[model samples]
Target chain A: MHTRTLAELGDALAAGEMSSEELTRHFLTRIEALDPRLNAFITVTGEAALEAARAADRERAAGRAGPLTGLPIAHKDIFCTDGFRTSCGSRMLDNFISPYDATVVRRLKSAGMVMLGKTNMDEFAMGSSNETSFYGPVRNPWDLDKVPGGSSGGSAAAVAARLTPAATGTDTGGSIRQPAALTGTTGLKPTYGRVSRYGMIAFASSLDQAGTITASACDAALLLEAMAGHDPRDSTSVDAPVERYADGLDRSLEGFRVGVVEEFFDEGLYPASAAAIETALDVLRSLGASVKRVSLPNLALSVPAYYVVAPAECSSNLSRFDGIRFGYRAENPRDLADLYKRSRGEGFGAEVKRRIMTGTYVLSAGYYDAYYLKAQRVRQLIAEDFRAAFAEVDLIAGPTAPTPAFDIGAKTDDPVTMYLNDIYTIGVNLAGLPGVSVPCGFADDLPVGLQLIANHFEEGRLLNVAHMFQQETEWHLRMPGGEFA
Target chain B: MALTRRQVESIANLARLQINEDEIPAYVRNLSRIIDFVDQLEGAGTEHVHPMAHPLNMSQPLRADEVTESDDRARFQANAAAVEAGLYLVPKVIE
Candidate 1:
């Protein structure tokens, strides 16, 4: 039951071998038993989930179920689910229950999927490691001491530990992919606007995207099919038609053009990560992919540009929580200014405040052009670099991180070192393209990931490629040592 | 581009957050590295390019201005540290 994919569970549910209630109970029991050690969930919606599961069972009995009907899924804490506390992993929102559902949550519920719980994440989705989570750092199930890479770390860790079969994740600057890489799970960040952002707690609005982290590429495809669509509520939601992601899972990779970015491998990559990438390339070549070297010369500057642009946007987006509208407020304030100051000072964690301060500084009156405007210009150049490279290659490939899971607190003191963890994954976000992290091999007893990046709205192709590679390898099937606790 | 300790304190105050004096050195050092990294953008020369705020250029279609949403004032204010009726309570200003 722990290792079963969503498709298999759905088939079992359809065949009358298992009821959604039973599956939901099994996962709930597992979460209750293991979540203390993992800290993967912020809020577990047991009653609501069981109620949804029972309803799903009845719907399936009526023969009105969709592909995801009767399946259990967890949401990142960032997505607002009405009646459930959507904390965004911050003290500011610790007690705040959403009045409405995020678009993704609404769509998944409409598809008849059961909502298991809300998973933990970095406070306001700020950090690379899950360490910045105000709820406490989520541990990698593979190794209890190492981090499960972050912002989406709780979602990745939950799925990997079988606390949930599949979970929703949001990526702003590699939050989903990096955690997925470290936890030995599959995560996909669709093209910006491919999934609606309505009701999702904003971090950096321009770069944020919602996707899935599951056991397999096929599972990701199933969730993506249901989650990807335009919503009138989200102004930035793309109106393009979503493709049948799971329908083409068996597509042959023969004659597929896979481009390996030279800069990704040239500098700042760990030797083991480099070797795992090379080995994955060999696997792709064996499967009939024509591997070639491509260059995105300006790709090296992605981390720097992202720090400016993401923080600037975050500072603006987070200003709405000023102790007057919603969320936490300071006690016994002397005046409105003190109320604002003490509330924010107490509510937000260190990293979030650091980013807010940095953003406000850069976007201030005297420094806008030298910082914000210049960063945007560099952002264009980075986007153009991907545009030029994609013309020469169908998909880009590289190591997801410099190495596998680093120990917790190894890079905590140094923000620059922590930011470097997203070096390979950040470029895709800057270019507004789709990217995924699939388990390729293990380095130093930890799982390493091979990143697959495709052009905008190319999610189907990216999943197809990932499915082909997964078909030839069993890495995605390997579970961490534990009997589903 | 490196910020002095005084500048860091000023920025922190401007953002309405309180940081300990001892934490300033570490924050200054780390923020300086990141600022230096972003300073490279000065060479990119973005004179005429419009800042692309979003990926898409289309505007969201507007609907008739009807209230599709009901005010959940009670539920929303449940988490506030202090509240009265439907309004959020805070320290008075202009007294």
Candidate 2:
């Protein structure tokens, strides 16, 4: 029961083999027993989950339940759940409970998916590793000493450990896919604006996207189907018709053209990671994909460009957190300036402060053009490179990160080393393309991820390709041992 | 392309972030390295490229203005360090 895919879970629910209440209890017990070790959840809404699960069971009894009707799914702490604390792993929002649901949460509730709990993340979804999370870091279920990639580390760790069959995550720059890569879970970041962003705690709005970390690509397809859609509430939400993601899982990849970015396989990448990616390419080749070496020369500039643009946008978005608002306020302030400074100083973690400072500096009067404007222009060049490359290929493939999961404190002090982890992924966000990290092979007893990237609004195709690959491999089926088994 | 320690201090002061003096060297080194890398963009030919801030160019639609939801200010402000009469109380701004 614990190892069944989401589709199987749905079938079981429909067949009365297990009630949603029973499934929810099973997961709740697993979370209670395991979360203390993983620190995956900041707030576990057990009572709400049980209540929602019971409602799903009632809906199933009435024969009105949707495909994911009774399946339990957790949300990253970034999404606002009306009655639950939606802290984006920041002390600034540690006590902030939203009054309304984020669009993704609302859609999931409407679909009757059980709300398991809120997973932990980096402060404001800013860091590459989960170490910057104010609640503490999430331990990779595969190896406790290794980090689960972040800011969606908690979501990836939870799903990998079988705390829940699937979990929601958000990526700005490589939050979802990178963490999913490290934890050996399937996570997808839909094209920009595909999922509405209203009520998602804003962090680099242009780059931020809601996605899922699940055990299989099929499970991700189901979760994506439930989550993707336009909402008038989010000004940037693309008004496009939602597709049946799970319906095309068994689609043949006979004519698929997989582009292997030559720049991605350059000197900086880990040798083991490079080998695993080559093996994944072979799998695609076996599935009849015509693989070719493509070059996106501008990708080399992505990390530097992303740092400027993301922080600049983040600096603007996070300005709303001043003590005058609903979040945390400073104590014993003699004046407004002191209040503002102390509140932000005390509330934000070290990494958050560092980013805020960097963002503020770059966007300041004198440096805006040299940094922010140049980054945006470079971003356009990178996007154009993808556009040109996609004209010759159907999809792009590479290693999600340069290496497998590193030790917890390995890159904590070195911000550049941490930023480099997103080198392969930042380009996807920069180009506004959809990308996924599927477990392909292991390096040094840790999981390595094969990254699949598709053109904008090509999520269905990407999922189909991933599902086809997953169908022939059992990597996604492997799980860590614990009470879950 | 390295930033001087004085420049780092000035930037930190301008941003209102209190960075310890000892940490300035590392921050300067790292930030300068990144800045130098991004500086490579200056050589790219972007003269004719209109800076694309967003992928899609569609304009946002407007709806009739109305309050769709509300939060209890008193309850919401309950977690704040200072508050008074359904408003967040900040330190006195007027001298």
- Candidate RMSDs in order: 1.6, 1.9
Candidate 2 lDDT, tens digit per residue, A292-403? 9999998878888888888778777877877776777777887877777677767888777667767887888888888888888888989999999999999999999998
Worst 10 residues of 2 chain B by lDDT: B12-21
Chain A alone, TM-score per model: 0.99, 0.99
Instruction: Enumerate the candidates' DockQ scores in order.
Output: 0.61, 0.51
TM-score of chain A of 1: 0.99
The fraction of reference interface contacts (C-alpha pairs within 8 A across chains A and B) present in each candidate is: 0.62, 0.45
Which ranges of candidate 1 are over 4 A from the true structure?
Answer: A483-485, B45-50, B57-67
Candidate whose lDDT is highest:
1
Per-prediction TM-score: 0.97, 0.96
Give the number of the best model, judged by DockQ. Answer: 1
lDDT for model 2, on a 0 to 1 scale?
0.87
Q: Which pairs of residues clash in candidate 1, taking residues 3 or more apart in a chain or in different chains?
A: none
